[model samples]
Target: DAMVIQNPRYQVTQFGKPVTLSCSQTLNHNVMYWYQQKSSQAPKLLFHYYDKDFNNEADTPDNFQSRRPNTSFCFLDIRSPGLGDAAMYLCATSRGGTGLTSSYEQYFGPGTRLTVT
Candidate 1:
């Protein structure tokens, strides 16, 4: 099985503040994804990485991502977090796909819970 790791289990931030979340994988999969999940809602794909290429959801704004193969890491940057941004940030990795949407066995990290004041 692939291993995905996320740092800092919990986070607290003030409204309009910027925050960064990170994820790293040992599998070195070609695709990586970031998701935002609410208390009882399904996870929503924020963006994904295919190697150095990034695919961001069209509706997601004020979000950015970067890849560092040297560390097998992907970082999610929320430029200005709002109350709505208070959610669990999930990091997942997959072996191969035309796009992340078509991938399988997306090994997921435990996630980082973000709280907005």
Candidate 2:
């Protein structure tokens, strides 16, 4: 089945080291999104790509960056890993753009758990 996939389900990085999480999908969706979930807290929308356009949430930190090299793949880069940055990074895809008539449903990958030491 066509779905989103995240690499290296688990990752460990030293403090101040850079780490990258990846997501790829076979669905050929037009929109892709990245989210950060810490423990029981709600998932925070870091940013998303609608086709080639990049949109970042107002609250998303500068430490969080994303790259969509192409339609089927996206990358999340953390310039400097910190203990507080450890969390489950989620990658999701949706068929339609944000609109009243467009479907808002999103399919997500299992997620990559990042641990900072």
Model 1 CA lDDT for position 103: 59
Question: What digit string (tens of lDDT, one per residue) describes model 2 on residues 1-117?
Answer: 999999979999999999999999999999999999999999899999998899999998898899999999999999988899999999999988566758768999999999999
In model 1, the Cα lDDT at residue 108 comes to: 92
Model 1 lDDT per residue over 1-117, tens place? 658999878999888887888898899788889998999999999888887788979877755555555538988888888888899999999876666556577889999999999
Clashing pairs in 2: none
In terms of TM-score, the best-performing candidate is 2
TM-scores for all candidates: the values are: 0.86, 0.94
Candidate 2 off by > 4 Å? 98-101
Give the TM-score (vs. native) of candidate 1: 0.86
TM-score of 2: 0.94
